[model samples]
Target: MAQAPPMNVLEISAHFRVEHDKNRRQFSIRLNGSHDKAVLLYDYVGKKTVDLQHTEVPEAYRGQEIAKHLAKAAMDFVVEEDLKAHLTCWYIQKFVKENPHPHYLERILH
Candidate 1:
């Protein structure tokens, strides 16, 4: 059965469709009728952990808080899956610090 998205995921979807591709280890948003994308990249560590490594938004798509949405989607996935996270990406680190989610923040691995 296809499961429902988490509440935060649903909320973000309303603004932009943040798509997660597990095999690719990235979460991305591509605007409608546009080919560019805003993406957050991560790497799996062991079995239940991830290292958020980088985020990039096309120049044409910058200054719209798209990175923030990507951060939220990726972090929400980490929390929903009960996985530990290592915030190697500066933006993700900044995002977490700015918007506190106790349960999600607790999963950060140092």
Candidate 2:
């Protein structure tokens, strides 16, 4: 049987979709008709691990929990792809520490 999707998929805002740019190694969210974006950056380590490097939200977009959305999208991707996560971004680190999921939590690399 197939496992359920991570919480992020159901919880992510319908107003924006997190777009994974594999070539750019980042996940990004943009509001409709807006150039400004919230981004989560990551880099692959070998084949199975990803180092979550940084998260950024435009000044105009701050205080809207966009960072949290980005974190959720990134984590959801990690769980979906069966990849391990090494969190270097402080926001993402705090996100995982604060919001624990049974299956998703196991994917974190110390």
Candidate 3:
């Protein structure tokens, strides 16, 4: 049997999709091409202020900018909802600091 070639970042990312379960208070993305693969998890606290609590990406997906995508989605949700943000998650705090988007930064809870 001929072996299949590995997928590039764009191809891999294209196959994945993020789901926001408001009931569960989490954002997740399943790994592509594997039914049993671990998902990237982003847990948050939502109210007047949405506290980004934790982020866990599968080891295999690290360095692929998956976490960045997850953070962006969560931040975008906060912005769209007109709520403040509390960065309790270290990764999220760092992401906001490094990326420095004015829209996101303006909503951060001091």
Candidate 4:
């Protein structure tokens, strides 16, 4: 499906923080209640690749475009760092498939 451009529900705030959540088994995106919100999780898998391995939304958080928000944050990071990503995570793969503008495509895919 042609998903709308992902928004950044995960925002930057004065208290912005990204830390591991042992309970969720992933990094937690959080803020101190500014215009920021936590909407996704990810971590590094290798030197050049980040594993956006498990992306989820609490049931109540569903359909608010939270996953898309996460995609935006992740991809923006990839682009900012001038990095090539390996999307081992299925949801991330799906995100790329749904938002193909060539900018996000890995070299191998071309």
**Per-model TM-score versus the true fold:** 0.86, 0.84, 0.75, 0.58
**How much does each candidate deviate from the true structure in C-alpha RMSD?**
4.3, 6.8, 9.1, 10.7
Worst 10 residues of 1 by lDDT: 4-13
- Predicted structure with the largest lDDT when compared to the true one: 1
Ranking by lDDT: 1, 2, 3, 4
TM-score quality measure for candidate 3: 0.75
lDDT of 1 at 85: 95
Which digits, one per residue and each the tens of the lDDT, describe model 4 over residues 3-94? 55433333433334444343343434543444444444555555665556667666655665556656666776677666666665676777
* lDDT tens digits by residue: candidate 1, 1-110: 98655332234756687888776788888776488888899998869989999999988778889999999888888998999999999999999999888988799999
Residue pairs of candidate 2 with colliding backbone atoms: none
lDDT of each: 0.85, 0.84, 0.70, 0.56
Comparing candidate 3 with candidate 4, which one achieves the higher TM-score?
3
CA shift of 12, model 3, Å: 12
Model 3 C-alpha lDDT per residue in residues 24-58, reported as the tens digit of each score: 66766767656533332434455477777888887
In model 1, the Cα lDDT at residue 16 comes to 82
- The CA-based lDDT of model 2 is what? 0.84
Give every collision pair in model 1.
none
Off by over 4 Å in 1: 1-13
C-alpha positional error of residue 70 in candidate 2 after TM-score superposition, expressed in Å: 0.8
